[model samples]
Target: MLKDVFVVAATSFVALPALAQTCAFTMECYETEACQDTSFALTAELDDSKLVTDFGDLTVVGVKRDAPLITVFATGEGAEYLLSRNGDTARFTAHSNDGPTAITYLGTCEGEF
Candidate 1:
């Protein structure tokens, strides 16, 4: 009976789904040198739980732009990011499993080029 109970508990725990949260965010990339003017936009659906849950300092990994380096802030999942660009429009990848996908919390901006 104890073994059976343990097995049932384990099964139930495995059946539990991962926590999910969602939000909409956008980041615009600027020029490589001056970075004064706007160049492109990157938008993503972020999972709130996985991101910087605490309002602490967001750790920025790296940034790239225009097939090279650009000044921009990104905060979201580490999963495969599907990027779609048209002229100057930006869009994010849509997941079929869940909505409001997890996101890494990118910080805000207050500086000029």
Candidate 2:
């Protein structure tokens, strides 16, 4: 019984990390200040959207304090920059090229059928 219990506990420990898994994404970006020819992949999620982008020895517009980090992006004209959060959505905008890009936190989403 003790051996079976230990096996179950080990399985739970192994499976918990998988259950808390997050999604990954890739994006290509290029601007005057920075340019990235190669695409990089980073983890992301629909909720509390976290992304990681890193171009090794590639031309890019900015610097990171850490080796990898996530940034926001937009599509089309007037399209709000989107971030995910457990079924909630947040939008951000590029305030300037000087900083890590300004992200205006849009509140959580509500109302559902």
Candidate 3:
């Protein structure tokens, strides 16, 4: 009986739910500056608290994630941009800052995570 109990406990421990799960998303950003008129697209893959971006309109150089937020760093010529997003949803939103200029992106991301 003790052996059976130990086996059951071991199985139960293995069946425990994960504390955290990774999220992979593909997002397209259309309309800039938090609902303005300039179309763009940017996608990112998030794992725990890290993100890697696939460049579309902006060349992603580096990425960092803090909880539900993600920031992707990029640059081109004399322009530098800081891009960021929050959460994982189809209705995706992102923000970018280049010196005195700031831009926002809105679109759909491919994920149910």
Top model number, lDDT: 3
| Candidate closer to the true structure by lDDT (higher is better), 2 or 3 | 3
1-113, model 3: which lDDT tens digit per residue? 99999999888867543232223334344344234444444444333322233443445577666867655566644456554456543233343343444434444444422
RMSD of each candidate relative to the true structure:
15.2, 12.5, 7.8
From the highest TM-score down, the ranking of the candidates is 3, 2, 1
Maximum-TM-score candidate: 3
Tens digits of per-residue lDDT, candidate 1, 16-101, equal 44432222234432222221222222222222212232233233343335632133333434433333333333333322224434
TM-score, per-candidate, Cα-based? 0.21, 0.28, 0.38
Clashes of each: 6, 11, 1
TM-score of 3: 0.38
**Deviation from native of the Cα of residue 44 in model 3, angstroms:** 4.2
lDDT of each: 0.33, 0.34, 0.46
lDDT of 2 by residue, 1-113 (tens): 99999999888866322112232332323333343333223233223233332422111232222222333343322233433334433222334445434433333332211
